[model samples]
Target: MSKVIFITGGSSGIGKSIGEFLSEKGYVVYGTSRNPDNMKNHPFNLVALDVTNPKSISNAIAEVITKEGRLDVLVNNAGMGITGPIEDTPTDEMRKVFDTNLFGAIDVAKAVLPIMRNQKSGLIINVTSIAGYMGLPYRGIYSATKGALELVTEAMSMETKRFGINVTNVAPGDFATSIASGRYHTPIFENSAYKENYQLNLDLMDAHVDEGGDPIEMAKTVYEIINTKNPKLHYKVGDFMQKFSIVLKRILPDRMYEKLLMNHYKL
Candidate 1:
């Protein structure tokens, strides 16, 4: 029997690309969306899923398990982004971001852990972002969510190590996707303190995302991770400049690294 893989937020963007790529490679792939009918043309199987809802997540996974009897991989790719200065971002909005990006992924992963343990094998790939390594202006909430998820994945790796399970974090920098359009922005009024800087940074960041690296590269990376029996804990995908930042931050002095990032964003 073919290996079974379930991907969240698979109706479009990177999730969709990964699903199709893995399917072509012979894995039985199931992709989830809030509306399955709209994604019928997608190459992989479509299941209705709202990661934020426990019932929806359980139902989706149960549907897959009922037919497949086993889930070899779980890709927690369902997430949303938000932009604005952290101070200006409302409490509710921040919670909403975490609800989807952080908690939703955890909920789904929890639901699948037992199944994978029962089978005595599985892989969990959490689609995090480069921001998880460091915070970015105007994307503070988004960064916090990814950063939290990264830590969760790290701890999960340790806990699941003996279960014949593997977990990997795929952190792509500025991939060309629907993320910008799908993200929520904090409201800015004339009195807003960071309004001007926020607008400037948001526009520049949006351009980077529009011209960001190909999602196909990320798909290939995911495939490689899946094929590796002992995959690395973290895989960063994007241009050299973005990838270099990860290293630069580690070696450079705190103030110097902060200065470099500030200059890059023209803060």
Candidate 2:
């Protein structure tokens, strides 16, 4: 029997790639997006889903369950980014980011847990970022959202392990995705403090993402994990720079790490 997999944010970027990859591998992939018409048809099913809305989440799941009796995998990949200095970001916008990235994942997991628990077997993969592990200047709010996901995935892994379910958190470094460009940004005060410095940090981060790793690499990693009999709790995928950044965070002193980031960003 073919395994059924449900994916959120499957319209573009890494989610789209992962959906396509898994479907080709013979999994019954059910992907979700806010606008299903915009998504190009693949080998799997596409359903309308909006993570921020509980009704939308429930309806999508119901539709899938109605068609397929069992779900073998759930990939919580739907997320948005908010880039700006922490102090400059409005509280409303910050909350919106978390609503989509963190709470959204939780909502999906909550809805799917019962089915997985009843089945006594399943895998949940949360698509986090390197920001989940380390914070960056100007992108503090975005980092916080991913950080929340990382911690949630950790606790979820422990809680679900005994139930025969696996929860894996994937923290990919800068990938060639539309996240940097497609992110919704609110303008900071034109004459406010840190405007110049904040702009500089945003520019640097954008440049790095423009020249980052391939999305297909991350997609391949997701496919590999899904095929594994026993998936691990966490995985990191990126180029050499990302690996080095993780290492620096591990060994370097706090002040030294801050200094390194400052120099790297040319702040």
Which candidate tops lDDT? 1
Runs in model 2 lying further than 4 Å from the true structure: 40-43
C-alpha lDDT score of every prediction, in listed order: 0.92, 0.87
lDDT of 1 by residue, 197-259 (tens): 888998898999999988989899999998898999999998998899999999999999999
lDDT of 2 by residue, 139-252 (tens): 888888998898999899999889989999888888778888678675867986888887777787788888887788887998889889888788999887777788889999
Pairs clashing within candidate 2? none
Q: How far is 160's C-alpha from truth in model 1 (Å)? A: 0.9
Worst 10 residues of 1 by lDDT: 35-44
lDDT of 1 at 194: 83
Q: List candidate 1 stretches off by more than 4 Å.
A: none
Q: Candidate 1, overall lDDT?
A: 0.92
